[model samples]
Target: MPDSGGLQSVEASQRPDSQVRVFALPPRDNAAATTIVDGFLEALTSDDPSYAVARKYLTPKAAKDWHPERQTLVLEDGPRPHSTDRANAEETGRNFELTGTQVARLDDEQAFQPDDRRYKGDLHLSLVATGKGKPKQWRIDTPPHGVVLGKTDFQRIYQSVNKYYYAVDSAAGSGAAGAQKRLVADPVFVRKWADPLTETVKEVLAGPTRWLNRVVTTSFPLKAALRDGTRSLAPDDANKLTVPLNKSADSIGAAQCRKMAAQLLYSLRDLSSSSVDEVELERADGRLMCTLKEGAADALVAPRYSEGTEYQYFLDAKSRVVRMPASGGAHPSPEPVAGPMGEGERRMRSLAISRDQERAASVSGDGRALFVASMVTNASLGDAIAHSGAKAEKDGFTTPSWDGQGDVWVADRDPKNRRLLVFGQGQADRMQEVRVDELSDDARIEAVKMSADGARIALLVTENGRTRLEIGRVERDHGVTDGDVEISVADLRRAAPEMEEVTAVSWAGGSRLVVVGRESGGLQQIRYVQCDGSTPTGQALPGLTRVSEIAASDTDLPLLAHSDDGIVRLPAGAAWQAVVKVGTAPVYPG
Candidate 1:
């Protein structure tokens, strides 16, 4: 095949505005100086932490000081190196100007911040010989300070592994011994050397990352290490991991033991079909204490309401909170629920329901105050958990999201304080404002939904003058006497980074979410994506207009959206159906 200018122009025109650089290691038994440099650079692009294969391309000393997490140079295109024929080419070192658009960077603290600038620099390369020989195999002597990778490869190789942590508070009236939720979705580079299951368990035992340390607490004993290190995690014939902990955990109690085992099971839930089906914890003396089975992972940790138990609530023609049945056919009518929020000026601006169907949280008519009221009869409007704390623009709070544990989560889009606030329910609820200083570059939350399991949050953030969808890990810390609370949202990362304007988001299932946004084409549409930032090839919502909001629940309930053509819906296993002629927001318990 030969190249043509006309063909090249057409292919270039079809390329996306955001181009991801490609990184592939070249094949070579022995290394040339250029091959060593190339292989080292390729390994930097990988998600591998220890840089095992990458170290093979480096000298012993250089590999030890190379910190890939120190900084990340996100390039717009692949790196190109220029070779020299100097007498001391392998000793004196070579230099070249590596120029490209640097889109984002990860700091020494491992926080990802978007830069989006044209980066130009002179990068130097130092090389060493394998041994004393004429055609000696060369290796990198001085490695680069930071990693460089294409955006596409970064997304492909870097995966977020969630570690289960106990909820800040437990569900009221539930007698479960230890309830857990997957909290931290720590991103790690996938390499043949690092096993995900082993890494996840080990990381949990090592305790939550620094950013989430203030919020999430682990049941793993302090400084607890796997008995045999990473190699101790081999699953037995029952697809079960018999974890033996170090002597430090010998004094831990039975309840704490089950929570620790639950963390292992839920964290490795996806691997149930292949490597792990259950997690069994052994005492320091090699005595079995508990076994968390695969089928009970979700129920034991992230439990949800059954699909048959309908709690489909929505806003009615009078802008009042009302309940609608999932079995309601095309002409199903809704009844106004009893509460102050349903009556006077307290009429809701936006509303959300807890999973237990015991309470409903709502924004005021003016959206400045947030109130929680009972969903059932003879219940009063609860206290105004938050007052407006805005300094710059329009001041208001979005819909209040209630988790399964009775804690309330909401974001005040105050430009002065783009604070995500959490209130732990009690005789006197305690509140903590999340410190999201650079969330999507100071973006304000327009709409947010807490997943039924209370692990993750789907946020519709207004960033760079456009709406985008992002998922944040829900990390909480609470106290016993006072119900002290603090929530730390994970560092901002877009779920649909390539999409132009994301208007709304809702969790459609445990691991999937339904979002309304557009990439490059027609009207805004609804699509599905994994919580870990992967696109799922599900059927798109057909004949759906631009939606103002989206509402979903724990079961096979209808997918409801508030569009310009009134409240439209897509019923379970059926086509799109219009539910009401007049409604602004549709909601369900949790």
Candidate 2:
């Protein structure tokens, strides 16, 4: 594709206007390079010298090729117009003389040489018409091999121009180059890498240790006065003097006295050349002694005696008696003697001494009291009952339960044998023990809880996946026999077949008992069953996970469920809400 300057105009036979023709020169051998360069140069019209139209046809490779150097096209004329007169032509030619001409002549004697393939040369041609009716048109056509297009040159031109425009647009569009210019304008940015140690040294020189010390000293009165105020004075004298600036009242008084004492002692020893020594002062009766140092005469040591002497005292080298002196007078008469006290008297005195020990443990309701089966010693149980001043019976057994009337029912947990012992309050030896082995395997009595009226007892037993709730009548002598204990075994799988294990069992209100079990899906379900050990009466309470323990509140309206996460208060008919969180083990009151 020819450049704008190289475009040729041809005379149109049909139209009055001339048509401009642009020829795309083919490369010698490379087809790709020829297309790229030709397409690019053809785009450089008079209207778009920036090659805006040429860029569309230019590939990325072609754009890269023409980026570096400036380019221009040189055009040659083919034919000259015919002249009518020879004289006029000669006169015109004489008037227009061409200079700076070099001529090369081919001699006949020299042999014609073949053109070298690598050598490039330019051809100059001129044509003139001399005697013709209509001057014949003379046209010079480019030879195929002599003036053919070069693919490398064409591609290089396109690529160079494209790159120039790309760079111009990139810088102008993003303002990245302008930002870089501004950044470089700062001297800090330019010298950041130079003399880094000097910058560190300057920073160290500007550190604030001195200023911080000044601030602290200016704000602390005691320290400032101690460091800068008067010295060698008494406390009373120092109090009369004006207080130092920024010093607190308490701190000023104390510091002034201390400073005065320290300075006086230092001056006496250093400036006055004085020394201190201790001495013993003896009294005339040789029964008492006193010791003191010279400067502290006002201070006294208690009188002491040696070898049954009457008086003795200690004095300093300055002849100052430092100890309390004995008086020259007779001693007073001794008081009347008393006999030694007996064990009974001592015991009476010992009643005044208080002992630190747990006095008693009591729960509000009798049902809860029975639920917390006591394994406590007989003395403590008796003490608990006696301290309440209620009728308490020890039953000659460690495990005790107080009936509403203060009668204690003690159960002995011996397998193959079950004994329910009954005793009156404070009567440890007088107890009636009843055997009820036929009712249960004594080891299976997992828990025991009395009813609210103390007339019935509910004993729970876990046997495999089945739990038994035995409701028994409280008897005076024939206690908890098979006939008295009404046993009902609840197959938990049938009741709550999805449960993996029962986590907790507690009695709620009336005959309602709560059995909390963990399901296979890692959720906890609390089922309410009657005392007769029947199927759960209501819908299983939902939305509990990992229930570790459960306790019924005293009011039986809220069930406290303990889990790894926290303690949740599950209302009787509502969902559970976290009430408290315990990171460690929890202690629940009965």
Best-performing candidate as measured by TM-score: 1
Residue-wise C-alpha lDDT for candidate 1, range 2-79, written one tens digit per residue? 675555334544333322433445326555566666676777765455667777776667778777757776666755
Cα lDDT computed for each candidate against the true fold: 0.66, 0.29
Best candidate, lDDT-wise?
Answer: 1
Please give, for residues 260-365, the per-residue lDDT of candidate 2 as tens digits: 2222221222111123233222222332233333344212211111112222121112211111112122221111111111111111100000001111122212
C-alpha lDDT of candidate 2 relative to the true structure:
0.29
TM-scores of all models? 0.71, 0.26
Report the Cα RMSD per candidate: 6.7, 46.8
lDDT score for residue 564 of model 2: 59
Judged by lDDT against the true structure, how good is candidate 1? 0.66
Scanning candidate 1 in windows of ten residues, the lowest lDDT window is 184-193
